[model samples]
Target: MGKTLDNVYKHQSLVYKYFLYVVSVALIVFFFPKGGKFKYEFQKGKPWQYENLYAPIDFSIHKTQQEVEEEQSTIRTNKTDYYTYSSTVVSEVRAEVSNGINTLFQTEIFTSSQRESLRNLSEEVLTDVYDHGIFQNMPQSRGTVVVKNNEAQPIAPNDYQNVELAKKAVTEYLSDANSYGTDRLSGIIRNNLKANLFYDNVLTESALNDELSKISYTRGEVDQGKLIISKGEIVENEDFKVLSSLRDEYESELWMGSNYYFILLGYTILVALVLIMLFLFLKRYRSDIFLNNNKVTFIFFNILLMVVATTLMVKHYENFVYMVPLCILPLVLKNFFDARLGLFVHVLTVLILGFVVPNSFEYIFLQIIAGIVTILTASELYKRANLFISVGQITLIYIVGYFAFHAIHEGNLDNIEWVLFGVFVLNGLLTLFAQPLIYMFEKIFGLVSDVSLLELSDTNSKLLKELSDKAPGTFHHSLQVANLAEAAANEIGANAMLVRVGALYHDIGKMENPTYFTENQITNVNPHDDLPPKESAKIIIDHVIKGIEIARKNNVPDRVIDFIRTHHGTTLVYYFFKKQQELDKDADPANFKYPGPVPFSKETAILMMSDAVEAASKSLKNPTYGIIDAFVEKIVKGQMQADQFLNANITLKEIEMVKKVLKQKLTNIYHLRVEYPE
Candidate 1:
């Protein structure tokens, strides 16, 4: 069993790739709904393209989403209140009367007879206030139903009054008893009164929710075999509602039917077919990503992740599905790969989501257009402003697409759902965070994005800075090679940024023994001259190994490190080997060659040629334009004869273009331009 798994783990094999393709497709297909799909499509205010439609079963005509939401908001605003009557209000009134009488007797503000009359007036008025019920504000329209001893009594809207009004009644009762003490008596009575008719939140919420749930979701019913709409007839708002209800009823009935499992199987197969197309596309065109398990998994993971997010939002927060930031997928993929692959994956994801979301056509249409805009405007994403601009364009596309669809449906822009437009704007803002997401994926999946490459190419970066201070000459050589390679890569339609960054850090190993290499040696004493040929060749070859170590230690991406490993392309250090050969006829040449796997990509091949041509161009004495052109040809031609570029995915035509760029660049550097007369 272990051996069997070992064979499966070999990612480069055809069997391994096929296994991953099946597994990835299977996992994505599992997220699809088990309910059956409708055979025909319909939209509001559009002509019915299919034949006359009829309902096969009796189903309720559900209200539109907008109508249901509006009803819910109204219910929440005017919900009935459930009140628990506390006999505590009577006790509170008695306490207020007792405290008032005690204070009056202690202060002696009133004579004995007047205090006695005040106490009698206060008791009668307090009893009347408790009976009328001192409440907080006025009662709601549906009325507050007070519960006591399992009996519920409804209080009228006008029956409940504020505590101040209750105190005024007490003051009126006392005005005749003591003409001077009416206002003072009211103040003492009002301070002790507390509204005991407290709002019962638990019971109130339960009652409100019960009322909301009782609100019928469906207003009418359609009988079986009823003709819904005729062919070529425009679907009005009423007809659209009936059709949507029928769709929901059909799906719900199918879920409980005996053929439900078969429907699930069909959905699984459909999703799998879409995923299979993507797999074949990668296998045929993007085999570099296909051959690596991590990269292929990353792509499928992103697609599945986006689908899951869309599915959850559609199932729950249906109105806010547009705010899920679907465009972020294409923007991130485009930054890592190309626009074509990004758009392709995004289209597939949106299609899969279309199977589950409402108004499938509009959702798919808006997302695909936004994805295209994302790919077009998100180039050079290392610049923060480019992402911002791209997000703006994507949001604009979403808004325009939504408005156009709305105009078709309603025949006017009156009562547009402007909140959805705000959702698209929020989506655009969320997409700007894809840079950090890209960095996270790079860490988790061991992938490198263009943003990382751009940062690595900066001369002020830590590793580049160290290289400059330790080995200035090698750093200068690297910069020239970067310039030459970048131009050549652009000419050949290769990844210019990747090759430029790779060229900048290709010889970082030379920092370990800076003065041994002639480029970094500034002193008269030559270190290599004192050592034997084999020993000196070992020192030269060790830079490649040491450079790999340094790069890995500093967390350099492996893609850039490939240039360091393959720049020499199994070529011999001829200067030292020839010196040994002159001393002894049988000196082994293998000891002087750099260990290499050869270049496997156009960018790496361009680097190899540029590195060779730029280093050799320094040897030209009193160089002319023709001489520099020939010098570029000789070094590249020798490398071609050695078949150094055979393994790289580079064509002879592209190699010719690289040579043209190199000759022109070297001429500018060495051969002077004709001075124009003033």
Candidate 2:
């Protein structure tokens, strides 16, 4: 029942933490970007056709006719200058309308009622103007005017426009608009201009030109020479929607622009999410304290590395983007996180960053392949130590990765020899240099990685050395725990290294009283021998607590202290309580017990069981392997039934595995000596 309540309390304690974790991780997932490489997409057409064609080839030299003639002539133009060959352009405009309804009329440009009025006026204007079309002109003799130098200029039938003809043409068009209101005179002028521009009569063209020149000073008419409409220039309407003209609207542009933005944004999210997920998974499997902190730190470090690498790759030299995501990510992640996460994140990073890298899926696939192979090659890299081998290892991953990439992406491998040579140089030279530069990013981020583990075993480390001097008894207990926990962790497929490291300091609290604990005793005069067993048990129980206080002063981690306090639960002090029951029959059951909160964690519970089993197994004079096996199971089952192993989340299956492992370990630890004496 007590064990049940401890379990309940332990669960209650995790509720808030679980809530925080879920909410934070949910935020991450909500914002988690999905990763991808780009498919073959039509980016866009070149800015302009002439510019596009010119950019690809050099066709700038301007050749002359003489140069063209000097070359082998395919066709003859002129051998002799019999009549100086030249070109002449003549546009004969006439006011003639056979025709059709106005197609250029935009209803929005002109209102509905106004559109009807403009149509009626246009018809009336066309008819009246066509009726009184050509200007009445008297034909003059066509003769050649000869000068002193024999310059002969021809004199035509109609020399130029006269005042009478101009008045006649203007008067006739004004008569067309007499019936209608002053609706669209400019529009009328435009219609007349279009007719004249397209008409084939020279006499009618002369009249239209004469009428326009007569009103040249007036703002009502506009004449910019030969044609009213320029041949190639673009014209647009009011709403900027290019109704009947040729200009690309901004709407289509914005649509394509947004798609590009979404793709880049999505890719960024993907890189970040993959790294975060990898970090989270590793943290859960490792020891909770380090797992949580180490992963969080590494995640931030990864984001920083990616952002910086992206910025530099894009800013300084654009070609290296393909290299950074695949090569840099794996190298840096290995330097900052463990090799496992580095491998997975490297794959994801390569795939995602491919989108922003301006490469197709086929091109980026090689990057992913190379990075994964590189990380696999460097899996055993110990960066803080083994600098020489580590560099070689990184170089190998880089080289192997690069070649694999080159091979995978190289659709045409006609250059296999060259590719192989490049791979060798890349692995042997480039990676050696690149890996070190990438390592700097990991250091800058303050992320301690697996290589940083060596510092933990340092004798000068505050917690380890403090355990040795101040709390030698707890320290001894911790060593026993390290062995037991690591063996159990290994059996369960947990992080044995993490378990051992944590276990080494689990009893950091007991150092408060070096002489109080049994393990630290030099002489075998049990301290309880002088006192009532009840008082003795209280003193023994107090050591678990005293260990906590000492551990606290020394700044031992909470995970370590948890083992110290929870190792011995609130189980009754059986020896003391049973003794009091006989001597002082009325002594309260609770009063004789040591205050124990049952084991509430796997490490602590394992320690408690192992600590008892290890001591108990030493009692037999001839402790054999079979005896150790039976004793191991007995101690484990005893602890379980006593309810001391309840709240730790340690499964019975795991406990059974622990029993089996303990038997094997204790056999070697307490191996029986052969009876050699005769």
Candidate 3:
């Protein structure tokens, strides 16, 4: 069973999902209708009895090597006696039977006299009823039913594949048995029945023909037939589907149970906890592939979405029902992270949830395609209207799926059209409304989501107003940063709106001490003009750290706080660093630098580099496009080499792309004036 599971899977931990297998089997046992006429219901001696799965091997009956060697020696010694050639050996295992000719012998409980009588009757009937053919002289017993000289013999199920022997056995058994019993046996045989009708007919070959000819015959067309399912076959085939339905219907009820579902659920929780421990110990376990300024809230939302997805799949069935949500997560999570990471998670979830239901192929196929489609459609997240695009894609996908299913699904239309349309609507609502759902969830639960940008843009946001009132310059500077960042982010297909909103609120810390930073102060009499350079640097760098505290206390979104903390990184306060150095030749370069750590994300790095370059470009007294270009390049590279480019998803190539685009925009913003009158 374990080896069979390995063949069907790709990942290892998912082997843990066998818990579902156990739970399913247990449910079958618990829900066994005690008073019903069910078969294969864990009852002893039933073909599909549950005990078969865990039953211990019958090692007690195993033969010793010495016994096996003796058996092999007998087979070699008997080869010439049984075969046309001595070189051939037969591995045909045999069991002692009550007789040779009765294919379905009366069981061992039969009297010895009856067994002998049956054997003798079979030979007597065969001699008078059949003719031997020259081409194939006799049947060899490789188990199953075998015939020699038109007489049938029974063999065990273990060797039934010998077709030549099986055919003669069937022919001989059917010959006289058609009328063997008093006319009482003329009706169809019961499914779970034992019979020797064919064995009885061995001598009367013409009676075999007469029995078959008794049925009506039709000529021109192929005959269609209904397969008669036995009670045992029905119960075995009914299992997995029944178990799947039970899972969807009673998930919460079963999960809360003390034992049956707890084994699987508890193990899942343990795996998660172990992964958490591994995360802390390995440190690198999280694999920094697509982190951004909104790392925590982004991760929180993704994990939240992951759990929601798992629950939905567990609770629902149908190709589109559970499948749609499972596919939506990677796209949703990647809105703040990146599409690549979203695709990765989507693939992982598809493989896991693929097995949650019985017919996994259909659900998994739809899920993986829908997930990739959603990721492409929702590639960038920082917007309000992108939801519409997702909705559109979802609707289109559902339509395509509708047609595919319409042609292939085996069902009556009376039940399917409305359900299919509802699925279409449901998928659209989830995909399009995810952004709003995130917003509402964050607001209600006091959580943070990447969608928090919608709230960050509020001009009446207390921090923005405070910056505007206490330090209009800083407020205006933030607006300019918003414009610049938004434009740069858009040009390269990043989350432009998030960049704008983040830029707007990035300087909220300055509101705590507006005069300490230059952007917040207007008068030429700078605050740093009076203070020592190192002290000024502390106040300047402190805004980022302080902004984080202020944002947290005010219930600002955690994503916004992350932006504030990381935007500056540890890039040096060059002006203060230079002055402190001039004042003391031996002063360490780190003394006047912005307190430790560097920008950890593409969004923050862009903000840090752009915020510095934009402000510095504006102060260039008489800036040229070339000079602006150089300045943007210089600051970006400075931040880049400081290894400040850590968690950001921007490739070096993307940074260069960001640099080229920012230079063009800054050049226009800081355009030189013309002396038209002269």
lDDT of each: 0.85, 0.51, 0.54
Give Cα distance to truth, residue 292, candidate 2, Å: 5.3
Whichever of 1 and 2 has more TM-score, that candidate is: 1
Order of candidate numbers by TM-score, starting with the best? 1, 3, 2
lDDT of 2 by residue, 560-652 (tens): 566666666666666778887888888777764446677766666777777677656547677876677777777777778888876677888
The stretch of ten residues in a row with the least summed lDDT in candidate 1 is 176-185
TM-score of each: 0.85, 0.50, 0.53
As for TM-score, the candidate ahead, 2 or 3, is 3
The clash count of every prediction, one per candidate, is: 0, 9, 7
RMSD of each: 4.8, 24.7, 24.7
Query: Which residue ranges in model 2 land beyond 4 Å of their true spot?
Result: 1-301, 322-348, 360-394, 404-453, 458-481, 524-526, 529-538, 569-574, 577-606, 642-654, 673-678
Ranking by lDDT: 1, 3, 2
Strongest candidate by lDDT: 1
- For model 3, the local distance difference test gives 0.54
Highest TM-score against the true fold, candidate = 1
